[model samples]
Target: MKLSSFLQYLDALGLLDLIVKLKLRNSILLVIMCHEIGKNVYYEEGIPTKLFEAELRYLLKLRFTFLPLCEALEIIEEEPERPHRIAVLTFDDAYKGVYENALPIMLKHGMRGTIYPVAGFVERSVAHWAVQIGFILRNMKTPVKIKLESLDTSLYINDEYDKRIALKTLLNMLPRMDVDEINSVIQCLTQFLDRELLHEIQELHERTMMNKEQLKEMAELGFEIGGHGYWHVGLTNISRERVRQEIESSLNFVNAFMSSSVCKLRTFAYPYGLYDDNVIGVLKELGFHAAVTMKPIVNKANNLKLYEIGRLSPYRFGLMTLSSFKVQLMRVYT
Candidate 1:
């Protein structure tokens, strides 16, 4: 990211609020947002982005899960048994780095957390959509941006797959986008987008997902595996039947392969936190233990809908959360 772009991104109000609200001076309960780091191994420009290893030692205490997962788990266990509050470490996407980089760290620390995976990407064996997009961004020469119909900034894409992924992201995030408008925009994108490029990327990242043996091993290590839906599509757009199918099919595939009963993957982090009462109701009927949403509030077991625990997201860049966590810890606990 250019210096100017980075500065502008930091100026985002949502980002600012997230940092400020994190100073929970009165809260006894909390959770940490642990992210699965994407490729730092293969970037042509000497690593496109990174969350400096040093940062882990700084803000995150036993809460950091990279090199010190075991310690984090110990912290949880050592907490007072009041149920007043506990900090659970969680990683959103099961990136390949979870295996290559994170596993060793987790093992050394003996920390256990849930790995929420997009089912088809692992079970059926396909490259994750995000990884494919990142590959193109890291590989492309000319900086490309999608020319949108009404958007202000030109869509920035480093490669073809990035262009597709970014469009999909916008489609999912922008709720009021009508199908007619979507179709037109997608059609325009197809004119310059390279399907083959995305396909190649897909092939590469499928190999990146843990093979059956590795996944089974993850279970053996005592880490919980949760479903993050199949295809990782915008859940709000699909029909009720389709949602059930995605949820159940992925659960079936993982559960059956494990030689254990997943029954149903009630524990979910909604695809982009998009959920309807109807969608959740199906999960209730099916019997899910718990489901997590991307809501940014502390969750109470009694007040929650069971299938809708809120979570905090770790920012890609910033110092606010680090400093803020300390302030919250000092003011409230003392």
Candidate 2:
């Protein structure tokens, strides 16, 4: 098993707490990475809404102070010793569920968080590839053959399991394709399936991303808005000019939409949490204050970098019990 999984197993066994108690390190700021938070039929990336609420209550019970991402950054810079334990909640992709489901729970707890939305998706100019894939897979009635010329492979989906496998393989290959390539692949897949029915299904079930008005409301309601690129493509693998355009254009769109004092678009979350020195330089040049990655490390005042701040995904912790959550936090603290 992977080391992270093994650590989670140890945490489930209650050994991680003992290890953490023995180490006794200083308190640090933890950023929890989330995507969607609701009942999703096609995706498992999201935690159920009730479980999300329970996690928040559990954190509150532990006396962990929840702060907005910008506020957390300011505190770490201005007064590092103010809070013993603090966390910033952040969500990516700006799913409608976050606005519809997660926001209510956060407000109940008197907490605020950050959201990074793909500018293109919010503009309704592009559909999230994953959502599109899920719609196609679930709507397929008969066995179909899918030819992925980019991967030089042909996949046959004859059952639910085969459909899932094909979906997974397609998702894995999407980040590398450009806009036209991705659209071509989706178009090809749609031809094999029921295009008219799939469009209807997509119209009904696949409107999962938040629109501009919802995002505006979220910003007005004390949530920070950040950029997640224009097309949700990996920046590190793209050309330098493309990286600059993606980062700059995304931030520009977010700033124009929110237009709130509290919702300054100064932070960015890299697509797929993939970046390099070049990507960092691009963000720096664009006047962003900080950028977050999906790294498993905890963010401390002394060790935090503006460009490469690390965040922990709750799924990585195997969020089955409170003890497992504690162990996840401990993994980052050390």
The number of the candidate with the highest TM-score is 2
How high is the lDDT of residue 239 in model 1? 78
> Please, what are the lDDT tens digits per residue for candidate 1 over residues 1-334?
9644554465453463344346432323344455455444222111112332322433344332331122222333355342433445555556666666666665664555566777776765765554444454445444666676744435677666765566466544444333344445544544454666545554665455565556667766766666667677656677788778877865665464344322223356677678888778766665555677766665442234456666654442343333333333332221
Model 2 sits at a Cα RMSD from the real structure of 3.4
lDDT of 2 by residue, 1-334 (tens): 9656776687678686666554335667778898888857364556778778877886776567887787778767777655457778999988778988999999988998888989888776455778777777877876778777856889898999998888888888777866667778777778777646855644633367787878788777778888899988878778999999999898788678555736343888999888999998888888788999888777776667878888877654454444455566665442
Worst 10 residues of 1 by lDDT: 41-50
Predicted structure 1: clash tally: 5
- Considering only N, C-alpha and C atoms within 3 Å, which residue pairs clash in candidate 2? none
Model 2, residue 204: C-alpha shift (Å): 5.8
Scored by Cα lDDT, where does model 1 land? 0.52
Model 2 residue 272 distance off true place after TM-score fit, in angstroms: 0.6
